[model samples]
Target chain A: MSKPVIAIDMGGTKIKIGIVQGNTVLSSDSIDADSGSGLRKRLPFIQKAVEDLLDREGISLAEITGLGMASPGIIDSIQKKILSIDKKFGDAPGIHLEEWCLQTFNLPFSIENDARSALWGEWKYGKAKNFDSAVIMTLGTGIGSAAIMDRQLLRGKHFTAGILGGHSVINYKGIHCNCGNKGCVETEASTWNLTSIARSDKNFAESPLAHAPAIDYELIFNLAQEGDAAALHIREQSVQVWSACAINLIHAYDPEILVLTGGIMASSSQIVPYIRKHIETHAWTPWGKISIEEGEFPDTAALLGIAHLVGN
Target chain B: MSKPVIAIDMGGTKIKIGIVQGNTVLSSDSIDADSGSGLRKRLPFIQKAVEDLLDREGISLAEITGLGMASPGIIDSIQKKILSIDKKFGDAPGIHLEEWCLQTFNLPFSIENDARSALWGEWKYGKAKNFDSAVIMTLGTGIGSAAIMDRQLLRGKHFTAGILGGHSVINYKGIHCNCGNKGCVETEASTWNLTSIARSDKNFAESPLAHAPAIDYELIFNLAQEGDAAALHIREQSVQVWSACAINLIHAYDPEILVLTGGIMASSSQIVPYIRKHIETHAWTPWGKISIEEGEFPDTAALLGIAHLVGN
Candidate 1:
């Protein structure tokens, strides 16, 4: 029998570590991610997190066959290196993660983009199974997306293919995105931009949401349920943005299944249906309907995916 | 040496027929495509057009290996059938082009979406020859697009995959498209919508363009050259829309080569540079720059592409 694997999902807010067995995470843990000082500063903390998780699971480094790490930004999986990161893990390109893994665990190592890793998990073991083509759309702080088109992950010549889902323009004349484009779905709607979107509404000053410490989808959804005009307006607008994005993605990649992930899925029951209605009304799918699924393990998809990444 | 191929590019306004040898169309001719009735009514004319082209080239039916048709609709290239078409050929789904070919010329037949056919030509014999991934953007009456990713054409499960490039939303709140979506790049900038875009400009009534019989990109570009206010306003706005679309597509398909085609390329020398500048400034390609090339055989790319499609 194959030994267990160690998986790491490196994100902007958290570094999640897991011991994955088959398709399941046997044990998992996470640590606060602080990139203000760069990735090098967090190495010791990451090492401790993994060790503690292994200890709690009663597993040892010698029993692990390989380690997989999912990191943010552009990744050259074939070269086993991080290419570039705009905001998080500024030191990623300089850090030799594969070498670090070899020394730390003395095991084979592989690294992938966090979203792509999550897609790998879904495609291989979760919702995307049996489907030849699938797309993973992760909605949270910013939109994270990856596609498996024609039964292959869309890795373009630059290795940035299928990872720029958040940056695709959906409203060309709208707000300029941090990535340099304008009217991107991420700019129009997303947790990080939700506050900005809320503040931009004409009713913000007169609405109760203005008194809140910070704005997020949860608060907006909660307030909208109580018939807050500002909240309702923002919620419906975000849903349209997301639906437009979904249709745009459908036209771009033509996936059989679109797996929704990230923090926004917490209110999947309330919001997913609106997205579905919009897609049904506007998406030009002549052949049949696409299956939209919520990710089975939103928080740990990248971890479980990294296991497949290293294992395969 | 392989036998020559008969190529047909089925457009809304014209049915272009060609006798193609290698990558070149040795002889070509076109007939009016009157779809006011149905595709069945045009079959005999299509037959005559092919025969006339073969006669002009002094080629016999036995000298041709097969017939390839590039139709404007959803195509099942694998099954050699048209799946659906909203406009040009309403009876495409019921017609048997393969049977027609076998009966008329005893030749094998294959069909593909016109955009995909053009992409096949570019990828196989023109600008995209050396690239593993490529995308074609044909900006004319409508925005026609197709993609080749990971060394294969993106023919998704239903075969409407990469051909819907123009329909990808670039502005969520912009013009609604005839195909049921809003803010599509096609709706914002293609020739079919140029009139609406021009008329919406406040200066349209004062500008000389109001006296013109038709409002098209040619008129707009020509008027802009002469410093017409409405023309200039619409021209700049269209340019921005196209630029946004370029960046959006760059993110969507991640192609190494983006081959521009269709009627808009008539002003390629004047307009392509502006698009290049926008992509350079806004496209989030961290790996490297994408090569934007005008299609080498814009008028006959689909013809040559059909040759490759049928031959292969």
Candidate 2:
């Protein structure tokens, strides 16, 4: 039997690590990363975290075949380096992720952009299986998407092709994105964009949601379901924007299925059907139907994806 | 030395046939084609048109390495069949393109969606050769697009990926497309959609454009240049929509260079600068600047693209 692989997903706020064999999770652990801490300070914490997991599980590091690391930034998988960290983590671009793994465990490591890793996971072992082409979207703090075409990841020359589909424009005259593009789908509908979307509403001043200091899609979705008119309007508009973005992905990647993940899609009961119906009505797919499905892997999709990457 | 290839471009209004070798046209001919005449009837005309070129150029069929065909509609290059004719040639999907070529000249042939083929031509031999990731948008009868990723053509599982980028929605409540989608880029700004767009304008009744029987973009652009208020408004709005679409492609495809091709780009002196300025201000690429340029192949880009496909 093949040894299990370690999969690690490094997010802006947390780290999720798992021991995975094929599609099943053998063992897993999570920790609050507090990425605001500088890279140097975080290094020892990461080492301790992995060591603690092995101790708790009573597993030897020698039993691990490899490690797959998914991080939130532009990643050069070839070099195992984060190319641009942006605002997610300080000095991430300078870190040698492979070198760290080599020194610690003497294991081969592969790293990738979080969205791409999630897509790799989903396509290999989750809902996107059996499809030659698929696009996985994570709709959270920022919208992230990745395309798998002909059963291979469609990373462009700069490793930034289909992954940027979420930033596709849905409203030309809408708000500006942190990426500097005006009216991007992420700018109009993502969790990061939702606070302003809620604040811009006329009923925001009178709604119960106004009392909440912080707002996210979950709050908006729950409030809308509870009959908050302001929340309902934002929710509907957000649905439309997300649907448009979905259609754009459909058009851009021509995938057989779209697997939607991210923290926000925990409300997939609302999002999947809405996007599916909108696409059914407005999307142009004369050949056949395009399926919009919820992602089976949630927070751990990327981590699990690392296992698939390493195993494959 | 390999002999020159025969390239044919079938359009809604005209069919262009030429002998092309390394971007140089040794001989070329054009014939008016009414696509509404139906595909079965047009085949004889198209074949005869090409044969006429063979006669005029005195080039033997054996000397021609292969024939490359570009047509407006969805194409299954693998099957060598037109998938969806898009109302231009309703019977095209039923026609056997490869079989037709085999029976006619015992020659192997390749067919591609016109927009995609144009990008291929340009990427392989024309202005877009420098960039590995690029998008080509053709703004003619209908807005069409093709993308190149890591120097390979991006045809997703459904063979619809990069080809449908123009169908992306710019306004949630914009015009309806013939493709059963509402608020499509094609619906808002294309030769086929121009009539409805102009008719919906509030000032259409009062404008001098109403007096003109034909209201194509040429007249709109000329009138706008002459400071016609309504024309200028429409022009500005079209530019905004096109710019927004370009930004969407830039974000979606992550191309360092975006090549705008089509009949409209013939007036590139105006369109190139407008799109470049808008993209510079609106597009988000933190790494460096994105270069926006016009297609040097003009209308023949798609026809030449067929040869590239066959060579591949």
- Residue B227 error for model 2, in Å? 1.6
Which CAPRI tier for candidate 2?
medium
Q: Put down candidate 2 lDDT per residue, A199-247, tens digits, no spaces.
A: 8999999998789989988889899999999999998988888888888
Task: Name the top TM-score candidate.
Answer: 1
- Interface RMSD, model 1, angstroms: 1.4
lDDT of each: 0.85, 0.81
DockQ (C-alpha) of model 2?
A: 0.71
User: Model 2's lDDT to the true fold?
Assistant: 0.81
lDDT, model 2, position B204: 81
RMSD of each: 1.6, 2.3
Evaluated at residue A197, the lDDT of candidate 1 is 89
Cα lDDT tens digits for candidate 2, B1-312: 346887888877788888877666678888776878777787777688778888998888888888888888778888888888778889888878788888987888888888888998888778889687888888888888888887788777757778886789887767678887777787778788787778777888878788889888888888888888778888888888888889878877888788898876656676888899988887756567887888878878887787667655
Please write out the lDDT profile of model 1 over residues A7-119, one tens digit for every residue: 98887777888899778898988888887678888888988988998999899898887998898788999899988886677888998988988887788989888889999
- The RMSD (Cα, Å) of candidate 1 is 1.6
The best candidate by DockQ is 1
What TM-score, to 2 decimals, does candidate 1 have? 0.97
Considering just chain B, what TM-score does every model have? 0.96, 0.96
lDDT of 1 by residue, B79-180 (tens): 888887866678878988789889988999989999999988988788889898888888888888888887888787788778887888887877788888
